[model samples]
Target: MTDALSDLARAHGVATAYTTDRGHRVDVTPDTLVAVLAACGVDAGTERAARAALEAHRSERAARLLPPCVLVRVPVGDGSGGRGASDRRAGRRGGPQDPGGTDTTPPLYLPEHTHAAVQLEHGGTVPLSPGLPPGHHTLHVRTPDGRQACAPLLAVPERLPAPARRTWGFLVQLYSVLSRRSWGMGDLGDLAELASWSGRELGAGFVQLGPLHAVEPGALPDPSPYRPSSRRFADPMHVRVEAVPEYAYLDASARPAVERLVERARQLNDSVLSGSSLIDREAVLDLKRRALRAVHDVPLSPGRAAAFAAYTEREGQGLTDHATWCALADVYGGAWRSWPAELRDPRSPAVARAREELAEAVDHHRWLAWITDEQLAAAQAAAVGAGMPVGLVHDLAVGVAPEGADAWALQRCLATGMSVGAPPDDFNPRGQDWGQPPWRPDALAAEGYRPFAELLRAGLRHAGALRVDHVMGLSRLWWVPEGRPPTEGTYVGYDRDAMLGVLALEAYRAGAGVIGEDLGTVEDGMREELAARGMLGTSVQRFEYLGGSTGRHGPLPPDQWRADCLATLTTHDLPTTAAWLSGEHVELRARLGLLTRPEAAEKAAAAAERDGWLAELARLGLLPDPGGEVAALHRFLRLTPARMLGVWLPDATGDRRPQNLPGTATVHPNWRLPVADARGRPVPLEELPRTALLRTLADVFADLEEESPHDPHDTDRAPDDTTENANANETEERHGRPGSC
Candidate 1:
């Protein structure tokens, strides 16, 4: 690649080369760089054009007095301890000077005699002061030339709030955990029940749920929550019609039709619970839509009507745009790009007219959104009311489907000819194309990150904690050009400081914790950065190992685990503990041709890993016999310094299937399996408390709680002492083999 092209790409935050997971350096092709730059609205078709673009970019930056956005870190100490305002001004252009004239702090960059002011997000305006509170505000600047400019100013806290103490919770795939009362799949009501029961009865601190983002509506709804129609709204399919307060007010004449739908739902539930059928989301949504339409016919009470009106007003144009997209999709298939030119643009007059023509349909969709919001709020309230310190932790998918609502509605902000995906590495030699459109970095900043902020606010509204899937996307994303293989993709950088500032601001405002899924191929120092920002990371037990031989690889010592994490036995993308222990995942992978190597080789590797873990368990004195592996694993997790530990609900019930198997979309039933017992019979939520296996697992956690009480001053205990004491207690208990805890 020419130096000019490389410089242009760098100016636009596109990396020319990157190191893969295996430590090999790969340089992005010149053609790929030009294509990506074009997608970002930069003209770099030739060497001359590239040089011109680079020069223009540099000129723009040099001419601007203020950046497009500014992030100001709040001072750490009280006003009395820091330098006085006059002293701070003296160091405005140079380093701060101490009484002895030594440079004490880094140089401040604000220009001299430049008028600066800030307009707070809530109400008042104030001069840019040292002690200003943390918020999303606007900064106004007047240069010496009398030229004025405004930028989005973020006054961010040094770190987010941490959990008061070590806590435990159930990590759930919400749709898979069905109940006898659900309409074919688990709904918000089931979520509430699980949260309340786990919090009140089992003392769980939270119920982490899968992404509830709205899926594309069609005859066969997309079952993957990661590729959603709109991240700003919840999926109505997860709403329980009967749980809606208005359902009780349905007229006598509508009761028969509702009963018929209820019967259909019961049959659907039976098919799934019997373990003979997979979750049919399309059928489930069809039945729920019919019933919801019937309920919509009933007039709302005065109080309910007012509440609905208030919600509509608060949501404003965003809700209207989402509902309008749904209405249009119903008319012209799900993919908006295939629609007639007149109706393709969301802001076009033709599309506006079409929305008016389908006003009733739009209103119905809007009502669905409102009801879903209500149920989500209720579920979070139930969690906290049942004594959970952190309630519902909602998952936020990295991007939206290219043909979905957000893509059509925010077309200007999404890249036109690029897809977000991962580059080829050791594990996935073929890489992956997620088929989701990435946000145009330039457009995002130009829009002041309004769309991103709105999505975050929506997700955090009813959540006590929020988990950002692929959290590394906040700093950079792999952008694959249209028609190119994922291996040809290159990394595109984003404004990390601004993105994290907005996230921390919203999370702080909501008084919630943030957990970043920093599991796979994270960049160096990313984990430390997340920890420093008070955002927890995810750690899975099986992958946490020390260097050693195949059959003897040592499990990472419990005390070595980071305390700022939500450690788990496994994640939805991986196999359950039972499956892993039994080598079921390897067998299934072989059957589906998903194994890149020979079946024997894969099985041998899996067996060696399992054996090593078992050895570690025995060394800790946590294993009395082979039958106690599950209990022993839980005991091992409890010993970790992780602030929060997550119990995979299916693991407790001895489920032997993964919720999702990455790479194979059609060959394996991903995201469709129900939570089942050892015999593979689906277990409903109501039956969980009564199950002996679940009760035993819960007791394991209870035993650990009894052994270790909260000690605020005990944060710095020696790792060796802690591990030794835990092992000693386990050895003592193993003498008599206490019944399951």
Candidate 2:
């Protein structure tokens, strides 16, 4: 690539080259860089154009006194360097303090003699003070030329708030955890009941749930939660119809229709719970939408009307745009790009007229959003009120679907002709295209990260903690251009400092912990940066192996695990413990033609891995037998000094099926299977606690809690170096006796 092109790309925070997961160096093609630049509105069609754009970018940067946004890390001194007491106790370290302690926080990079003042989010406009309080502010700058400019100024706390204690929770796929009350899949009511039972009865600290972001409300709703319509709003499909208070106020005439809808819902719920079918999200939502429309017809009470108005006022334009988009989609079809030219522009006069014409439909969507928000809030309240410290930790998807509401509404901020995805790795050599649009780094900065900030704030509103799916996107994302394979994609960089600052600012305000899913070939220094900001990293037991490819494979000793993490045995994309031990995942992969190697070879490799883990469990005196390894696995997680540990809800019941298969979309039942038992019978939320298998797992966690009643974060545990040698020997023995299984 030419120096001019490189400079242009760098100016827009587009990466020119990146190291692959396999330690191979891959350079971004000049064409790819140019395409990405064009998406950012830079004309880099030729070498001359690139040079001109590069020169202009440099001149603009040099002349500007302040960036579009200025993030100032404030030292609140509430103990964890402004992160509060919970963080300090949880072993979260803050950023480096300045020498002499005058102002430890790093200074904002403003031009010399810039004469800057800050307008706080609350009310006052203060001249740049040494010790500014933590909040979002507006920075006004005056250059030497008398030119004035304003930028969004975020005064963020030094670190994020952490958990008060080392806690254990159940990691759940909410839609899979159905109850008799649910139509087909689980709803917010089921979530509340589950949280109440787990927290008050089982002494659990939190219940981590899958993303509930709005999916495309089309003929066939996408089952995957990771690809959502809008990250800023909850999916109305997850709302329990009866849970809405307005349902009670329905007129006598509407009661018969509701009763008929209830009967259909009962049949759907029974079909799913009976293990006769998968959780049909489209069917469930279709039924619920009709029922909800009937309920929406009932006039709101005076108090309810005021509450609804208050919600709309607080949500502001973002909510308005979302509802408008939904209404437009209803008329023009789901893909806004295919709509009439005038209607494609969200701000166009034609679109404004359409909004007026479809005002009722828009209001209906707004009402659905309000009701969903209320239920989600109730679920969080239930968890906290039931004695849980962290309450509910909601998951945030990495990006929005290309044809979804967010993409249509925020088209300017999202890159065109690019999809976010992963490059080739050991698991998926063909690479993976998620079909989600990448956020244009330049556009985001130009908008002062408003969209990103709003999304974070919404996710954290009713959450005690937020799990960011593919958190690496905060720093960089793999952008695969249209018509290109994932392998042809290149990494695009984001201003991590600015992004992290906004995240910390919002999280601090909400007093919620942040867990970054920092798995799969994370860049160097990323983990340290996340830890410094008090964001927890995710650690899965299967992925926490030492020297596997070198023929010396074993689980990393739990004591050696990082303290600042949420340890788990598996994730939604991975198989449950039973499947892994039984080699069900391998067989399923083979059956679906997902396995790259021969079936026997894959099975052999899987068996060797399982044997190594079991041997380690035996060496630690935790595994009494092969059948008890599941319990031993939970015990092993407790042995880790991680701040939080999560038990896969299915693992407790010995479910063999994985909730989702990463590579396969339709060949396998991805994101549709309900939480089931050893016999493959779906287990409803109401029956979960009553099951002997779940109760046994709960007892194991409870027993561990009693034995170590004090904060587990305070407990010191040394790494077991001998375990590696033992695991190596076991690997050798297993290879010698291939028939051991």
Give the alpha-carbon lDDT of every model: 0.78, 0.78
Q: How well is each residue in 115-136 modelled by candidate 1, as lDDT tens digits? A: 8878888989887776667776
Best by TM-score: 2
Tell me the tens digit of each residue's lDDT in model 2 across 1-741. Answer: 899888777666677776655566778899888887787789999999999998887788667655666665667564555422111121111121111111222334554566677788899887776467777678787766688888776677887755557788899999999989999999999999999999988889899999999988776544788888999999999999998887888889998999899899999999999988888999998889999998999899899999999999999999999999999888878888888999888899998999999999999999999999999999999999998889899999888888889998899999998988877765556667778898887677667788889999999999999998877778778788888888788777776766777788888888898999877656555676787788888877876666533234467777666777888998887889999989998988788887778899999989998998888888888979333778888878888778888989999888999888765665777888899999899988878878876766777678344443222234374434553332222211011000000
Full-model lDDT, candidate 2: 0.78
Residue 412 displacement (Å), model 2:
1.8
Alpha-carbon RMSD to native, per candidate: 7.3, 6.3
Clashing pairs in 2: 98-104
In order of appearance, the predictions have TM-scores of 0.91, 0.91
